[model samples]
Target: MEAHALYELLEKYRQGKCSPEELEQLERWYASLGKDRPDSLLEEGSEAAQVLTSRKLQELHASLGRERRVVPFRKRVLRWAAVVSGLILLAGGARYYFKPASRQGELVKEYRIPAAHSRHITLPDGSLVILHAGSRLEYPLAFNNNIRDVTLVGEAYFDIRPDTAKPFVIHSGSLRTTVLGTAFNIRAYEGSPEITVSVTRGKVKVETEQEGKLLAVLTPDQQVVYNNMGATAVRQPVTADSAIQWVRKDMVFENLSFAAVAQSISNRYHVNVRFEDEGLATCPIRASFNGTEPLETVLSVVCGIRNASYTIEDENDILITGKGCLP
Candidate 1:
């Protein structure tokens, strides 16, 4: 995401040598950067479009807490103009592997995991899958063109087979994750506002399923959290192993925010965690728990880390109080 690296990517894109994910990234960038700007800008030969195009660069600068200088815009705009100019071309050249409608009487296999239960199965292409509790997975009886595609309604961990010529794609809600060969986890349970993809090995490409807007290209230990309702995404480093601990019916936390950990616990135990101060919600936690541990024991350990105390109001909700992080 550095300026020089972006420039290199653009150059590679121009040469038609960029990988599938890279091209999708550039396309998504152009889409997001050009949002609500003006069609005339692109039609008018990028005089004003240049101004809108530089916003992406500026947005990156803003995120880094750097001062924006008018002096740099003039020079940077020229490099960005080429990317904006190709938006139309990218639209025309766009190719997607998804087929909206199945063939008449197509042989599709669907597996649904009940609540509080998990299931493991081998995909048609020899890929391995472990579905979390209350998850569903659907796929064709056999893959076509060496390209495997599956739809997920909840969370799943996959160990995909290597196939350079074929890409494996997973569709979850509005998020689409594409991988050539990777071990990754996708969490996209129904009615959840956020969908997450975490990679343990190899590379993965996260994108918007409807708009084909690339979200992020992730390598090992990388994760992208996409908020479907908010239409936003954040990519961050993670302990990939911890993210998929659900496969073992265990809880793993590695510098994860208290708010997130709370959600995980609530989902597993069918209880909500409430806090008075946002500070408590933001506390960083590092711990692991066996699935058999009682809920109160887990809360006790978590609160002890932050010098906090929790009192269960009922089986449905619990309250925790603390000043902030204790250590």
Candidate 2:
């Protein structure tokens, strides 16, 4: 069927004006098109083609009438997009609705964790997430038929449910992780030097978002680190517990420099720890806290061990001064 004919039929369907014969004809055309050349529905960068594609979507929603529940308009649009996207893909159609603009109608729910705090979330798919301090996660109000996808900033630990038909996907910065069911942790704080994805169980496929290149296929006790500055990834083996200590509110420092320590402390305590002597920033410290100690106590232990002195300038800032650590 011609694009114009399809559009007219869809418009009629949307208005509930299609006769039984016309409806059957439209459905047959849809099935036939799916089998033949579904990609012809939309031409790239063509305004007229986009309009027809959008109308076809509306017609599909109207025909199904399965999504008329009490939900936000944007969410309804997203549900339709997801369903259509899956159907088209299965029919060998061009991937159209993946674009942000095409799926803009899908409502997004965002959760943010403030400094010195964390939050636990249960997704619509029964996936569990623990968002670390100063982090944010954005996901659809409900997953689409094709995929369970979410975007994260800062850090989070995920325990995704098993759904082989619809994979769970996470997007952090330029990295994307896809898994059927897995336990993993992702640290992608904006200012952090790298984005890290560590898998604790099951398997995950990590890829670069821009090029859609496979970076790694990680299994249990494995991790992939993507350097934000260089856009490079390195896969390595690690102990799962070490990678996910933050979920337990446990802080572990293993021969880490003061600067790195400060960053971790700042994230956990929501305070700025500054080094008065820049040299002290490189001092190494090895410590572990169960996250039960008060911030002041932790700081005191750290300072006393390093022969450093610290002062709380205000509620949100801490200054540290000491002689440089002996090499």
Candidate 3:
């Protein structure tokens, strides 16, 4: 089930308002969570693994209410709704895997994007991440018990969920960024000369990971570029929006047929595209867009690369004419 549905169902359970069928469904879900796993093939987000996490979470609320003299049971469970919602997403359809964490106590889940591609990620905390090509992000399987922490490689733009009590932290190479709530970008590729942190909204604090030395406190439109080898950093002002312009529909087509590109363009631009010479559909095109160009501009570039020309028959239909694929 979806996160919202799970949440509504949880509320119904807490209110003692669930029908027998709903309760039966909940039991089946829990049964699935407790399912046995193949001994040889273990992985994070596995049903058995989630059973441990879910059990711990459920136990946490109970122990708090019993031993810690915590709030009432109902109230405490209600308070845990946020945590539960995030867990539902983990079991939902996010692409991720687990790695050994620093503490060695629990595994950290990681999401990676290969070179020449980008992906959008919704963190367990509901924060948004636009991971650029050749990047990876690592975080806990569930962001429930501790502060929000993540490790980044390469680059990504983050729109963090605001939680004043718990700060969000990112470790990118030697640089560490801490913020309570903000939108920012970090570019720190391996073997790169430097790591850069740019803030678009709210405030951000940049520091050295090892020594915890303060580097810079940045506000909107500000950024810090740190020379990793030299351990020197320069803080400056910039057009923050420009830094994030790549978060748009930047895409790459590697050795793709014109017909495939046409279909993709049509899907993206909400238009129909056709070829006068069917042979032209076989032409291979390799191109990348930084995402700022308009549809016409993109099509013009694509057509030029293929030694072809295109015309707009109507606002929604495009016609292309060209010689067959050039050698």
Candidate 4:
């Protein structure tokens, strides 16, 4: 199932509203999806080994009755930490595993991206994340009973799996996006002038880092853009299909400026692209091209449509100069 459909179906199942057939479909879907393993098999001392140990612990705890033991929360957490640490040691190489590292229990595991490189990741709970270049995501390896949370730096598109009991929370720089299983996009690159959250499906609540700032709720197709410029604007919902067209290797532009389009293309292709002429910076253009297309071909097509001209300087920079340029 696609992300949105899976989310909806999961939500319905949780609410006791799904038909029997739909529930079966949900089970089938869950079983069909599995994590991608690296080349090396996980040893008992590896991180993955520790994860398996943690899962066993969870199974043991589940068998306990609601009448419950009198174990203190702190002690319980520490015990789990030790188990997880030992497992990581078995899963990964033993030399790097430290007990302290286990205590750093992340509810979502850490996600890393190389400079100028974006990546698609699947969360432990089956949610999806598209991390922009040079971004990091810190989440616990697994979410315990209550809140599901994650911290993000940079940009990502989220296709969350619905589980109302565990509302998904994203801490992106100074902003937070909260949802009970929704699809959304967040752009909060460090040093970027602004933070943005655009909702494509379901609903999301956004709040500023500073307290007392009222939550901003977004409906499908809506976007919230906020920055220190004292500007917080709500815009008519743009089609998320267009916003995330990069996922398909297609770059779509509807009256987008040359500079903006170039930035997006750069991120998509993991390349440095420069425009030599300031005059072409503000030029408005409408076009769509696969990201894998030759850079020269893309520029040529855009220039041809506008009756303009361009020249590549040593294949690194492109200069577009012409009368048709809209400044």
Candidate 5:
């Protein structure tokens, strides 16, 4: 379909003059032509048609040392104009749907993680969420007239602002964690072996709808993990000062096994650390280090303390093996 036909069809559709079947046929034709057109043709210039003509014609002209261009100048110009105008309309439509309003205050919004990195997002209600790697967080483009609600995937830590009348509820998988005015962490990695909820400050009530049970009311320095088998609550002492060290370019490892440490480091730096030594996986260590330093330096220091050896094959791959301190 050409640009004139497309514009006519669109106008008819807006006026409700096109039949359903005609509209469908027009849409199909538009999709087929749009997919085949080169993006460069969507720009204006003398070179636009010069780049898209038939390759066979180019070879023939080369052999004869003579050019036989078929496209008339007026037709070429109109086609180019249509291409540019179509691109502008498409771009404007996309921006209208995706970007937030400049001055619109407090609208429900949704955010998703397309890559590995923590996303620092401020919600419409002034609450903040630090979305961890491989996570999804969705809320309305604007919040409700009263309370604030958001859904989560993977893991996220929330630092919520106080609102007396409205409470915040985060839905993770089937579990719902609710809080009035506090900060907490929720880990619900998809198909992960466990779902964890840790609270550094304030209080949160975690509820499981499967059994209609209140699993735990977590306070500061408390955590709960729910798996298919069951849920367990642990009351452990943790420094609130460094609860979210990952966001600060630092990771706190407290008596973590080698395997667990490798996973944490991988998520923090977006790199992979593997232990080739089978025995090294179980070696335990308690450490915290700044992420600003080269990962090799941190790895060297940790391996030195644990009596292990490692080699970095490249930027993303590090092999930690050989001797490891026995637990």
Candidate 6:
């Protein structure tokens, strides 16, 4: 059963609307969770964990009846915390049971992309993720709770599956982005000067995890840049597709200088690029590459555009020489 379904069933039980069979099922599921190992709930201060503890305590009090001496609220909360933590840990197993016919679990899985390479992953919920070079994504094998949560490091593009009842969330460094099934790109590489999130479809809510403060709510073609050094964020309009150009391996240049173009190429191909003449660095380039073409082919075209020539040395270093662009 999905998290939303379980939530609805619990609500019905609370309201005394469950049938006898349904009540039995709920009791069985709760008993199974009670048997889970302790030490699993890591986010004790989180709202969700608090809610779980409260609910467990209420159920326990109801079961024990007024004849039994009431435990202090503080003591009850501590005991329930252990129980809920065990439940969460059990949720990470490959198969946890609500019943024989309805087994569910959300085991965590992680993926990492090496330098100079990219990878594509289809999550358990059918969300598509394109992980850029030097990035890592940690997601669950299944989404079992009220939220779909994942963590990202470095850069990645997400095409999320829409489920209004469960918001998809990405935790990157200190930033948290929440969306209800949208397409977006995030760049949050460690040690980077800034973290940027750009939306292509639907909307996204960005926040600071530590303070739970809202930073920006962005729509299509919108982006937010968070400066790590200044601890500030700014929103701006941007061409959304351009933000994910690397996913398609499409190199696009619109009136960019040779220096900028060289840097882009160096980053993509993991090479060092240099202009032999300082003047040539200022030459403008207007071009597009599908990335299917060889690096040499792309370089030849760029050099040809400015009446320049290039030489490859030591397999990874590139040198360009030319008379600067037309005056």
Candidate 1 has an lDDT of: 0.70
TM-score head-to-head 2 vs 3, winner: 3
Show pairs that collide, candidate 1.
none
What tens digits encode model 1's per-residue C-alpha lDDT throughout 16-120?
367988867765554455354345323444333433354554564343223223324323433443433333232222211112364223335566644575655
Residues 88-174 of candidate 4 have per-residue lDDT tens digits of 333232222322343343323455555555655667798877776677777666677587778888777888889989999888877
Candidate 2: stretches off by over 4 Å: 1-102, 250-327
Cα lDDT tens digits, model 3, 180-241, are: 99989999898999999999899999999999999999999999999988999999998876
Per-model TM-score, in order, reads 0.46, 0.48, 0.52, 0.46, 0.44, 0.46
Position 253, candidate 5: lDDT: 73
Top-lDDT candidate index: 3
Q: Give the range where candidate 6 is weakest over 10 consecutive residues by summed lDDT.
A: 94-103
**lDDT digits (tens) for residues 1-327 of candidate 6:** 344445455545433367887767655554444333122332566433533454564565355333123654223323342233334433332222121111222334556554576655777788888778879887765788789988899999899989999999998987999999899999999889889999999999999877988999999999999987888999999896698788766378899998998877775655568888888999889999754345688799999999899998655568898776557
lDDT of each: 0.70, 0.72, 0.73, 0.62, 0.62, 0.71
What is the alpha-carbon lDDT of model 5 when measured against the actual structure? 0.62
How many backbone clashes are present in model 3? 0
Model 6 alpha-carbon drift over 4 Å, by segment: 1-106, 250-327
lDDT for 282 (candidate 5): 79
lDDT string, candidate 5, 226-321, tens digits: 774555444455555555566654356778887887776665544557887768877887887643344566687778767888876433457887
Best by TM-score: 3
Between candidates 3 and 6, which one is better according to lDDT?
3
Scanning candidate 2 in windows of ten residues, the lowest lDDT window is 90-99
